[model samples]
Target: MNANDNIKIDDLKKPYFVWFEENWVHDDVLHHHQKGQLVYVESGFQYITIDEKIYLLPQNHAVWIPPNAVHKTNSHSEKIKLMIMFADIRTKNSFYHKINVFSVPPVLKEMIKYAEKWSKQMTPDHDENLFLKALFNELPRFVEHSLTLHISLPKDQRLTKVIEHLHHHYRDEIKMDDLSDTALLSFRTLERIFKKETGLTLSKYQQMLRIIKSLELLSAGHLTISETAYEVGYKSVQAYTRSFLSVMQFRPTDFIKTIQ
Candidate 1:
């Protein structure tokens, strides 16, 4: 079976294969790869809903989706990507068993780019074969980044009321007086309760929520980068880019380029 047709292990000579594409549109269908797949976006916006956790596939960052993990890729009209599929024994590390993100290390990039070049070379030379095998084993150490902001859904009626308000009005420029009146608690009391329960101040939680929601929208490609930024309460594109790049390693436009 062709690796392009579905995840397959049919080719011995081509134990590792890379598929590079631009302007690809994928329907949101749940699927799993038989082999571990490194889904990297060189540029563009895409969302990978992996095992129920929503992850935005930002530019320059790859989601190291493990074998047998059910996931779906969401895109608008365009996506650009490079996928490296590995066989059973070829992977460099046996320790990693879950999805992870690593910095785009130089060695990894050269290996992939070399592989792309090899594909175009179309030779069956022994040296070329050895280079590919060595490249697979040369896969560098992977580092993971924690993107989750701690949040606690409280059982208290007053705090629940405040939480519900923030959820529904993430776009609004919320004010202290408005939050206090809605929660029916003084600002100080609300602040104290939020800190105790969620480990984040009330303002911090709201900002986190807006950024997370904005990320979701940006991933789906439903809104323009600037428009989505504004929808999540950002007053300007620069403010939005700063927040997005702070959490994710790439700018919004770079992200949009990869998903295409």
Candidate 2:
């Protein structure tokens, strides 16, 4: 799909499903749809911003976006394969109104591939409607494997500056005093407001950012564990490994093996 192309939500007929294998580098403008969307990432990663909360969808995971939720997407990966399934608002199940990330089951993955092929070979009709209904039935199963990593942005301009700085300089050693100065807040105030807004202390939030970025690097398979460690602000490979294991529940090598 063209980066400039915006899918028209109003033009979509009820009980319709369409799929796209996006292989582009673009930052989508903020938009919302009347139909809920299921986005499966076959390879690489995509960052989605919904209602000011950033959710990172890594490979082999899918995100279910509720209808009428404003969101935007940005991808830096050279190869991005995404299959998007649209569900009518009326047919949206209990997953509506919340964004969910889950491990895509093998059955549902095959169903998405089959639906993509079926939609191309046949026009809309009763059989397609039946297929759409079957697809909707399978959606609720995804919630069982939901991954919750709520990375929300602060509304305050001062905190926003700090967050932006962290993203850009996550590779370097970030000090609380420095961040406090950047936000024009004292250390105590910064800690209080950051935890209040994001439910994570400044240090924990920065660690989360490093782990998130490490996933992208490790999944890409271009960097060694030691390189990735220092690249993401960790002083030692062991520390990075422990942090990765604590957050991702797996070793870096194990994660690399899975992607391979």
Candidate 3:
């Protein structure tokens, strides 16, 4: 499939369909569709932006986008694999109505891979539809286990400058007063506006950014654990590991083992 595939997807008559695309490196522009989408990262990671937040979809994980939700996709690597399922809005499953990133359970993961054989529009009352229905039926339960690897960007110019600075200087010793100076606001005002716009305090937002970037570096296998820690701004490996565990609910070593 090419970049125009999305434009053609809505015209297909199926209630749902699956698309298997490998070696994906393109960055999709802002767009939306009438159907909900569940994108599973079959191999490498990808990032998707929606509602002022950027979500990291790592291997063995999936991100769900509700119908007509404006979003875009990006992948830095050319070796990434993606299996996407687009379902009609009429399914009326409330669980399909939100955007979230979650670990794809083994059963559903296999089911999606198995669906690659029918990688095109699927008709209703057909055997494939039954299988597709079963696959989607399993989504809601897994959503409860969604990951917190998304960073909320801010719309306010002051907060945006602060966020951009943090993105570039996250490894440095950052002070709230410095951030306030960057934003041209008082510390209290900066904190208040930052939290109001991004739903996260300044420090928490930077921490989330570090973790998200660390996942990219670690998953690429280009950096050692200690290197990744320091690269993401932790002064020591222990602190980085603790933060990784706190956010990911698993040690960095364990995570490394999985991607290995």
- Find the candidate with the highest TM-score and give its number: 3
Greater-TM-score candidate between 1 and 3: 3
Ten residues in sequence with the least summed lDDT for candidate 1: 1-10
Candidate 3, residue 160: the lDDT equals 72
User: What lDDT score belongs to each candidate, Candidate 1 first?
Assistant: 0.62, 0.77, 0.80
**What tens digits encode model 1's per-residue C-alpha lDDT throughout 1-260?**
12234433333355455555555456578877666666656655456677755565555556667767787765432545545445344344653356775445555665666666544232245665677567545543534342342235565677877888887886777885678887888888888887787667777777767776775576556789889988899999998898778755677776555344
Model 2, residue pairs in steric clash? none
User: 120-204, model 3: which lDDT tens digit per residue?
Assistant: 6444548778888887777787665677678777788777778889889877788868888888899999999999988888888
Q: lDDT tens digits, residues 1-260, model 2?
A: 23655545457655666666657445577888877888888788878888888888877778888888888886557798878877776743466668898767777777777776643322467777788787877688656656676578888776988899888987777777888888888999998998888888888888889988887887676888899899898999999999988877767886665454
lDDT value, candidate 2, whole model: 0.77
Those runs of model 3 whose alpha carbons end farther than 4 Å from true positions after fitting are 1-7, 25-27, 121-125, 257-260
- Per-model TM-score versus the true fold: 0.56, 0.87, 0.89
User: Could you tell me which 10 consecutive residues in candidate 3 have the lowest summed lDDT?
Assistant: 1-10
* Model 3 alpha-carbon miss at residue 155, Å: 1.2
